[model samples]
Target: MTRAIALHQVSKAYGRAPRAVDNLSLSIAPGEFVVLLGPSGCGKSTVLRMIAGLEEVTEGELLLDGEPANHMPPSERGMAMVFQNFALYPSMTNRANIGFPLKLENPRQDHSERVESTARMLGIESVLDRYPAQLSGGERQRVAMGRAISRRPSAFLMDEPLSNLDAKLRNHLRAEIAQLTAELGVTTVYVTHDQAEAMSLGHRVAVMRGGVLQQVSAPREVYALPENVFVAAFIGTPRINLLRAVVHAPLDGRMSIDLGRQRLPLPEPLSAEHQLLRIQQGRDLIVGLRSEAVRIAPPSHARPGEVALSGVVEHVEYQGHEALVHLNTGSQPAVVPELESARPQQAARRRRRAGGGGTGVGVLERLRERATGHVGGPVVSLDEPVSGRQDPHSPDRPGLMAGDLVVRTGPDMRLRRGGQVPLLVDLEHLYVFDQQGRRICPLPRDVPGLDV
Candidate 1:
């Protein structure tokens, strides 16, 4: 039978430095598959290691099947782990490697039957005699998984086991792994930076950033209703289009979003949710529009939930299946920093708050203070609240002055680079985040199978 795992406010750290895995708390139901997903150094691996008892928990508790397992050793956790680098025995043949754990437990017992069964299950029966060095990367990965499955562990912890493989092989193995875990009816916690892998392989995904849990919910819920700006921007492909916008709410007129040179009038008799935008009037907030949320259309074809706008086509990219059209709208595009830098910044903030000290912390603070403001002049930075009227049309804003809005469209929609094009923004699908990177537009929780 499978086991339920619960991490209650768990945190891990090396020395007294900031927590590697912050006060993270999550529950995985018995036999359910959960993916811990984020960019590199986001503490996904650390969380997995702590669950596996491979790393010590600096604070809080870990419960396995309603029993505290904080002090348990890795071998006693009733779990099997598949590492990213394929931690197979280099000198051993596939057959021996697959049955290594079983043999270690019962030295005299012949585990050939069990080993062969797992080999066949994983479609690796032909490579049983080959050593790790002689096997291909995919073959080696299967052998490693075979070893883990042969033990009949209660839970499986896979840490980006397919990261080293090519795209084709990763896709193949991803399906195989998902099927195998379901068939075995074992609870699983998988870790990966690839959102595709996380969304496709798990029943739910837990997104992490800077060692802190961002959002944990079903894949569709996380994608469709991201809890914050980071989740919204991180989950989508071609990235979600973000812009600095101001809310326009008149006493008697319908509410709208002011984009400097253009405006989107929200649907009238606004639903309770859209009405919440009124309180944000005249305040600069970030607006997010998924490529699919906007489409090329004329005013006559515009529907109730969609608003129209015009822009100059900057470029067109043919992506085989569809085309990506870049437009120059008179607004500032919001830029999200790479997680590589975010990791350090988050750690520094945690240190400063905790009154800790280190060379890394000091250096980070110095860099933050020395960083220049927005564009040509000492104007409001992207990190700061970008009021709509503050230098609206100025070309001085460094990263994105004239908003480079990219819209996903069908291949048949062709246009010249400088041609004018009309587009529609789906009001129902619009996302809003505050200056602090927290979601604001989606005030109510409407996602299914989610209580947070």
Candidate 2:
């Protein structure tokens, strides 16, 4: 396939104000499936509508197959679009719905044969006799897609076409759409705010925010190496964690970051061309780390580049295999130390006999000393003594203090409400960003950090 579509200095505005699509320029390859991803009112649908000629361009040109298509009408654009609300006529049968476009366009073609062929391809042949009102949500959606594909347009444009389906059906159709688009070998542009759909279906993703394209790249590339802060925070499930931090120094290929009060290093480095951003040493910057980049663990011996956080378990959200635990930290705490705080708090309670075991500062002293040695002050350790007793003067005793440490752990990991847990972070996977919110380090898979 060749370049199927191009937009040059495309600008669209509703009134005498800032443009909705600001001077956008993009080239879409033939047979490549691209998805415009963004939240509602972010101009994703506007871009698709303009390409389909549903909206008139205000200040630029749109080309289809190397020919300017700005003056073409919707019907003449050589593209088919499916909408969120499947706009099928309730009185019309599925066959008629799929065939109507062809019938309207061609007075000579046999509509029945074309409709049936397309119905079979979408696995909706059995529903051809049923009206839109008689079919299930997924079935109706399929009919809409079938109708669009039946036209055999040069390109397919879809705008959140599966938003009305149930969760299971939505996932099923997500895969089905990917398969169908690939099999049809037609250039396609899909618009959706759903990150899962974009990751699952698009050959490449174009992320937009406030009418500006944030990034345009393969789904995995956009997920792994986002172009900026907006893409980094918006593209993943549970989203990537953004923490305010500062650059310490560059070591080997990685860069150390001070997480406000604490210091930890990231596994990657800034692109050579953007290395100057890293010069703002100790200046406020934002660091991004994906959920998968950090793991929750019980306090244990950790090597260099390993950071731990300690906090009490505040809430636990069970998600079958793993649980998301919100830790009580005074700061926007890290996750690992929360787990460590759990065990030690429990252990110290058990060691105390009567008189509340007055003054348990020994443990606190040890931890505080440990914190001083670490970049950040010593983190609290979880795990109370095996015995169930309370130790006075120990920070873990009563009136639990809020400290930073949060973790998402596995189901089998024993933790209780009001209990402390040490959160062991795999600092090797830490990610750093510059003041502009651009990543300054490589991830672990592409580069190793301090041998974990």
Candidate 3:
């Protein structure tokens, strides 16, 4: 029988170290596949461990099948876990390893038939008699999965199960795991830092940062309507182009976003999303555009909902199917510090330095401010050099700076470096985030009463 899992303001901590899993609340329906995605140290694995009864919930509740299960023993949770390291017994044969759990659960009965069936299901039957040290990485992982499958648990908790395999094998096994889980129809919660894996395998993806849940929704919705700057910057390939912009809305003039050297004029009869920008007049904001949101074309070729902007080609990354063109538009890029990982102590030191004699704020409060874009100073140009530091975006060519915006185009479009190109921005796809990093444009249908 499949199981439902729910966490209500659940948190985990070890003494005074900042909460590893903050007040996170999530629900996973029976037979649904939900992926907990985040960078290392974001507490995704901690959440999975708590659900598996391997870690204690420091605060709040963990419910299994609508029943309170905070104090349940690991074995009594009715869940099986597949770990990252392919936890297997090196001394025992694969067959014995797969059968060990079943043997413990029922010592008098022979479990050979069930073990063989599980091995065959995972296509690891041929390697059953070999020791784990004698098998390949993929084969060993299959053995680990075989062990989990033999138990027929109601829920499957996987913590980067395929992370140890090669890229090709990981892709192959990813598909296999998806198929296997669907057939079993068991509730599954997977944890991984890879966005590609999360987008592909999960029925819904839950993004986490600094031990707090960022956003959770279907893959497409998460990609198309990211709730904040971090989500917008995290889920896409080549990364979204995030530029520092100032909204200029005059009583009788066109509303536009000023991007240092260029301005994006909002077309007349402003869209509801753009209308919301009226409240942001003269305010600094972050503008996001996915590479696909802009195309390399002249102003005359602009389609409906398109605006014009020009850029100088700074770099080109040619992939097989398409090319990513980086352009220097003299626009500033917003930096979301420590987007890949969280280092608390280093962050604390940086905070102390920025606070100019330790502004009495605590770490968690500072993290919340950083997440909301409140603590960081105004947008700074990464292309410029600081007084004592070397320029991070030093020009490859003398006097020519690197690009701040990346646009995807057909691979056939060959363009030379330093060439000026006209681009069309689809206003409908434009994203705007306030100084607090909250999405302001493309406002929700039922707008919240909170002030921006």
- Candidate maximizing lDDT: 3
What tens digits encode model 1's per-residue C-alpha lDDT throughout 149-258? Answer: 99999999999999999999999999999899989999999999999999999899999877888899888899888887778888988788888889999998878898
Higher-lDDT candidate of 1 and 3: 3
Could you give candidate 3's per-residue lDDT for residues 64-137 as a string of tens digits?
A: 98999999999998889999999998999999999999999999999999998999899988889999999999
Which portions of model 1 miss their true places by more than 4 Å?
339-381, 384-403, 448-452
What's model 1's overall lDDT?
0.84
Candidate 3 or 2, higher TM-score: 3
Better of 1 and 2 by lDDT: 1
How far does residue 213 in candidate 2 sit from its true spot (Å)? Answer: 0.1
TM-score of each: 0.87, 0.77, 0.89
In model 3, which runs have C-alpha deviations exceeding 4 angstroms? 340-398, 445-452
Task: Output the lDDT of residue 207, model 3.
Answer: 92
Q: Which stretches of candidate 2 lie over 4 Å from their true place?
A: 1-3, 249-256, 265-278, 298-305, 332-406, 443-452
Q: Report RMSD (Å) for each prediction in the order shown.
A: 6.1, 13.4, 5.4
